[model samples]
Target: MTRLWNDPADFADEMIDGFVAANTRSVQRVPGGVIRRDAVPEGQVAVVIGGGSGHYPAFGGLVGPGLAHGAAMGNLFASPSAQQIHAVAAAAHAGGGVFFSYGNYAGDVLNFDAAQDRLRREGIDCATVVVTDDVASAPADQASLRRGIAGDLIVFRIAAAAAEAGAPLAEVARVAARANARTRSLGVAFTGCTLPGAAAPLFTVPERRMAVGLGIHGEPGIDETDIPSADALAEQLVARLLAEIPDGASAAGGRVVPVLNGLGSLKYEEMFVVYRRIARALEEAGIDIVDPHVGEYCTSFDMAGVSLTLFWLDDELAALWDTPVDTPAYRRGAITRLTDAARNASGDGRATASAASVDSTPDADDASRRVARTVLRAVQEMSRTIDTHVDELGRMDAVAGDGDHGIGMQRGAHAALRAAAEAVDAGAGAATTLAQAADAWSDRAGGTSGALWGVILAAIAAELGDTGTPDAAAVARGVHGAAEGVVAYGKAEIGDKTMVDALVPFAYALTEGTATRPLADAWIAAAATAGAAASATADLLPRRGRARTHGAHSLGTPDPGAHSLALIVTAVGSVLAAPEEES
Candidate 1:
């Protein structure tokens, strides 16, 4: 088990601070993440890459010359908020446009798309290429649904090389996408990883057994089998990758880069031994190996796992692969180091936007302020509810998905509670208070559920205007709007075994109940409906998010997202039933 941490919630920020301090010559600290300390030429396209923070060298260590220009680091196993991504992109931007790339996870997609749209609205050109290289995650016919793993290094290197060579934004994006399409990776683990302050590992495997197709986020593996010998494991990895060669690429006589990556706890000596057999296997198949890599490139926090990636190279890609790189973790060829004076001349290059303070409260009357107080109390109740059931939620999610849903919801709820209190203290109206709380929840949590909750709360806040008292019908309309917003934003249906399964039912029941019942009574009935719907999700297979790949494993477990939402709504009903004077 992992040890060492003060306040697990603050671990990511503290780690980033120490990293920037140690790598001052290579990178400088920004609000959201790190950027290269060296100066770049005018009109050079900035290559920004990132994901969750647990994958160390993957994100921050790659921020330097000939690699990512900047990296937007998020919390442990979580995607960064849209505001954080935008900040990193803006700081990394020169006169040229920004190019974004990362693993194709749900949270990363939602936040990156939002930041890309925001940048476009501000007149800054942007393009994206999401890496989908893990062949084990999806079938070849549905390759677009796969997630990225160790192959991130190959794609990031090629794209950053193109950008460094002064290629336009479109060309850089094209090369990155091409590189991703040609790369394939598969991973297996002997044991699961433990998050900081956690009582146990995310999931466990029987002794002498290995889990196959495990994700980097502590997600449970899709299948398991008895352990194999080093040579046999290497052959298995090579055969699986060779089975899914990209179209027009021949395994025989093809040029490929084989990367034997150790997840985290695996020793370099073990990986080298495995790579020896991998090299022999490829050579025996008449394939030529180029720039073979054996070491840690991307990793889980402490997983004893290894993944092998094969990058099929065309002529252009082969040429680009020879580019010199100088980063904190990975380096190639000889390159001149930047002088102290030159590095000193260049500051952080951050271009930050000014934010409004809590003291500047929106205009409101007595009735709206009263409702805002109730909103604050409701948030407090939700936080307490999450704290009480956090462990249970984590256990449920660990059945198939990454076991961080409980911690994520706890982070979001606490952040929202604090923001609501601040807004209430500033004499804000219900709309402003709830809106601020929504932004806080999304910003701090930084996951799929976080983004969805932000959408839901923001829609309701819009319906509950600041000026007058919102009636029962207006409240029902707000709930309906929230349901619509979640559907449009998350793209999940009721039977997808996600939060939508419960949220949609609750919204509909509440709308019908409010026609003849009081607001509090209607909410109580809707909360019961949500609870039943959440329970029913156990019979459905997940069609979205990280759980989709491990569908069979989640057959008897309810989705943690849906269950958490049900819990929150039920808790809020009690707050709404409080005395009128207290509200």
Candidate 2:
């Protein structure tokens, strides 16, 4: 369990600060994350890698000489926002290009892709290689759908090695892709991890039982069985991975890099014992083990579990794998010391300041300002509602997914509320206020819910311009737009057991009701519809997100996303029904 923290919300940022302070010789703090302290050669592709925080020696700790040039560390168990990713990439860019790589989680993919697009638009050539190597998450035929776990270390290393060798961004990306394709991982858990400030573990295995095929985000495993001895466990993992060797890779005579990764709390001695059996098992299968790693590469905070990753190495990959690495946490081979003069050649490793823009907001009309105040009130109510139901929501999510949904929603709502209040105090219009709130929510929360809420609010803000008070029809259009925008951005359908199940029906009902009823009445009806739809999601299986990995474990539970959406919309409806105060 997580025992130390000033505040749960500030944990990630505070941890990064301490990490950079301790490793000042190797890394320097940037706005979004950390970058190398030393200089880079001109026209060398910068290899930037990252994901949610809490995974030590990965993401941030890997930022140094032969590893990642920079890491865009996000909130614990949440992907970095597009803005955060872009900032790290921009700071890391050394005139050649930027190569990005990370675990293939949904939020990570969305945010990283957005950052890649933005960098390209700014004429900074960028490429990405998403690591999808957890064979337990998906079948062989659907390997692309697998979540990246410990296998991502192999991809990050190969990509960074190619970059250090002065390969172009395209070449770096190609090698990273090849590495990901050849990597296979399977994880099991003896227990679960607790997030900072959480009262208990996210999920737990019964006494004497072991969870197989668990994710790194504190998600419960897909299957459970009686705990086995070290040798038996090693055999099970080796056999599973050996059975699903990547296409074109033969087990016999295959040169593989076997990484025995401890999730978090597992002791080094325990992992070494497990790896001993793993090594014997691989040798018996006629495989040549090269640089076998036995330690924590990626981890779920304090999870008493381990994962095995086999990176089938071709000639090119084998050579790349042999490259020297000297990160804060991971070091390999001998590295020549860089002189202080050479290390400071890049001049503090900070990105150049861009031209400043005007920071003033245009004063809104009387009607729009009044509407903005009402928007602030609605956001306030939503925040309060989330705070009230946060624990319940976390419990629902813990049934099949990582139990951070409640806290994530709470962070986003409170962040949005703060932004909305600030905008209202500045006499901003409804559109500008809501837009600012959306950005804050997304940036602060840094998760799937955060991104979707940003999309939803921004879409509505677009319909509610700064000029006048929006009528019922206009509000309905805004709600409809938000629904469509969420669908497009999240790529979740009505029956996917996500928030879409509630959002779509609510949008439709609001659109229909507003045609004949007042805005408050229409919203009330829509909120009720959303509540029912959210409840009905219990009957559906999750077809998307991390919960899908657990399958039947979530059968009787309502999706936390769906339930939170319903709660917020219902709270907003009550605000709409309240009597208007004087402007």
lDDT of 2 at 38: 77
- Relative to the true structure, candidate 2 reaches a TM of 0.97
RMSD of candidate 1 to the truth, in angstroms, is 1.6
Residue pairs in collision within model 1: none
Q: Candidates' lDDT values, in order? A: 0.90, 0.90
Error of 2 at 268 (Å): 1.0
Q: How does each model score on TM-score?
A: 0.97, 0.97
C-alpha root-mean-square deviation, each candidate = 1.6, 1.7
The candidate 1 region of ten consecutive residues with least summed lDDT is 348-357
Regions more than 4 Å wrong, model 2: 348-358
